[model samples]
Target: MRNAMTGLALLLALLLASGGAAGAADFPLAGTWTLTAADRITPAGVREPDYGAAPKGRLIVDATGRYSLQIFKSERTGFASGDKKRGTPQEYADAALGSSTHYGTIAIDAAAHQLVFRIEGASFKNWEGTTQRRAYDLKGDRLSYRVPTAPDGNVPVSEWRRER
Candidate 1:
């Protein structure tokens, strides 16, 4: 009887340990990722090319439910005036069109494979304090998501790879 009880206790301990480790492995959304590609798809299902040939971006999501993302076209021309405040109107417009940034809290619904971003602020004032939901997939180190159609009716899909 004593030997049987000892064996059962050992088995129970091993099972509990394995279950805890599995739970940790299931939550893979916490980490820093860099954007590798971004494409726009029209409502009619036409897929456009990426934002630029060498687009650059970074995305960071903390374990504590916070995230920030910044993406910009590579090789933006510097202001000819050599002063940020003195840039020409054309330069300002070009800058705005080439880059976007936003920061906010994030929530992951693992069961649903969805991510929710509650924007606290953004470079574009119109997006301040808005909540967005995206269907996300994470495979190995690659993460991708399909953003809902924007207010302008343009759908954007972005892909990121984990930064080692």
Candidate 2:
């Protein structure tokens, strides 16, 4: 009887230590987050603002592991032709450089604490059908992550706050 009690105690202790007895939540990142700030840092320690000071964007992650994000500068000018489809080359170039959008599925690596985005479609032509791994942190209502460096040697960082 004493040996059985000792074994039971050991099992209980293991369960408590491993945190496996209380099942973990499945969807920790399922919510809408709005971008609060974005900045780019160069390898030479130069810092540049990204998407302007008061950028507008939304990031939505659904329970089904799908995600979409859009970020844009607030001061973008309207197309010269007053129509999106008829925008001149310069207007189209300005819009493309000033905004970003992507949608795809996300895979979380709990051990590594990183989110892998398997991008299906993106406004930036080069990013479509690409996979990007971003290290992320979630604290209270804030989420922050770093984007892979751009061709211009700038590393982008973005912070988002949960929407309600």
Candidate 3:
């Protein structure tokens, strides 16, 4: 009985020391972050990495609760001489890497633990209708989120590492 009580006390102490009964603060995401990953997920539960060739980017969040992103992609065009240089799956994915600039805002509902990301640009937009809003989760240096697939019943979940 004493051992069990001691173990339970330790567990409670650990939980309290780590910040008790509190959700992740919305203030935790207010900073500049580099794009460490970009993935395309399928409805069949497969995750394929889509960003390569140093897909660099920045996310800036201001004090008044406003944010914007300026991201860049290195142009990768393989030599064409019947060599099939840029025609492979990896090659094609690399070739499509180009400058994709987008700007957006981040909003979170403390009650629901949901993050709403609204992003827009000149040409493309996610099927979220206007802006790309998603429910997000943050753990240490990692951030993950899920955006519901277009008109379809699928969803894409992506994980990203924080840039130091």
Candidate 4:
């Protein structure tokens, strides 16, 4: 009986050591996020759809407030391609004719919980070089992000739920 009890106690100790508390959502946003929608707010305050390759890429943010972001912009607009994901030389030529690109940069304000994203490289052609900055909020199992208006009386709002 004494030996059995001792063995049981040792097993319980090992289990407790290995099973720890759940971690905070501190570093989960270190992956690629695709752009679901990009809106072009006309001067009349009416929002329109400006087509481009779906903005897709990865974001690597370190704990020290340094990060790298790579996002693929619209690709199909200026090409006559034989395959998807890669365009033929002619397709490349065509795509360049219209001159469209896609990219995103991100900086986080942990104290204020705001996310500053500077987008350029062809995505801002419609916005006339204005880098849109938005408020970012994150809670347990919930993420909320908002973009303020362009002062032209039109604003775009975006929300992202945890992927998993």
Candidate 5:
């Protein structure tokens, strides 16, 4: 009985040590999140939907700190030609402006309340191989962040809810 008790105590100690390490490695934002809203705040303080009335998006953050994000305007016009390469200038412009996508590794600076995205690729070529930072807020199962202000004096905001 005494030998068994000693072994159990040793096991408990090992578990405690490993648990601490795992907890340190665990990412708070690691989860699949769905976009709830994509909005822009104008200089006049009006909040308007940036991706139409109903935006569609998904964000997947894995345990390894890699992430994939995609957001699209639900009201985007379809290409009438049914061929991407044959699209008109207006169709191409609409397609480009109607969606945002990127995949890469993410790092969080909790002290600064910032998220740094090391984009591997993006729908916008200018974002490829770039590092972008955003101020973020994470509460309960909801996460929200604000993009850098655009030249047009609009501030974009993205809100997401974790998927069950």
Candidate 6:
């Protein structure tokens, strides 16, 4: 009877291990991704780049739901002084406006086609402690999402392609 019980316990352990692997496999978005586009659609139906002509960014989402995202314009002007702390007001403004970065815990509601971000920190102070929800599309290796409308009556969209 003791030998039978031990065999049962081992079988249960193997089942649990396989179940965990299956769960991870079911989560398709847990991977590194590269930005494809960052654009905005104006109220007048004009589509324009939101992060300059050659925007650069990365999105990393882990199996445990933690994520870090960053986007930056390619044409940001460099400070003449070459010192971050000694940047002029215009340089500071340029630097601030040129990048978007945040780290947060992410939750996806696949049935709703939406994802929520519980932002822990952000380059933009206003978003540091905010919760944002975005409607998303996941097609094969590509993921796209739309941000909330901006004050300028434009809707921002970001597209990413899975890297791994």
Whole-model lDDT values for every prediction: 0.82, 0.85, 0.60, 0.51, 0.91, 0.90
TM-score of each candidate? 0.78, 0.80, 0.55, 0.39, 0.84, 0.85
Cα error, candidate 4, residue 47 (Å): 13
Cα lDDT for residue 151, candidate 3: 52
Which whole-number lDDT from 0 to 100 does residue 87 have in model 2?
A: 91
Best-fitting candidate, scored by TM-score: 6
> In model 1, which runs have C-alpha deviations exceeding 4 angstroms?
1-27
lDDT of 2 at 40: 87
Q: What ranking of all candidate models by lDDT puts the best one first?
A: 5, 6, 2, 1, 3, 4
lDDT string for model 5 (1-164, tens) is 99999999998898676654565447888899999999999999999999999999999997668999999999888889999989989889889999999999998988888999999999988899998899999998999999889889999999999998
Highest lDDT: give the candidate number.
5
Deviating ranges (above 4 Å) for candidate 4: 1-28, 32-102, 126-132
Clashes of each: 0, 0, 0, 4, 0, 0
What tens digits encode model 2's per-residue C-alpha lDDT throughout 48-98? 778887899999987657899999988777797889999988788779878
Which model is ahead, 4 or 6, in terms of lDDT? 6
Candidate 2 Cα misplacement greater than 4 A, ranges: 1-25
Give model 5's TM-score versus the native structure.
Answer: 0.84
By lDDT, the better pick of 4 and 5 is 5
Clashing pairs in 2: none
How well does candidate 6 score on lDDT at residue 61?
A: 88
| Poorest stretch of ten by lDDT in candidate 6 | 17-26
Error of 3 at 160 (Å): 4.0
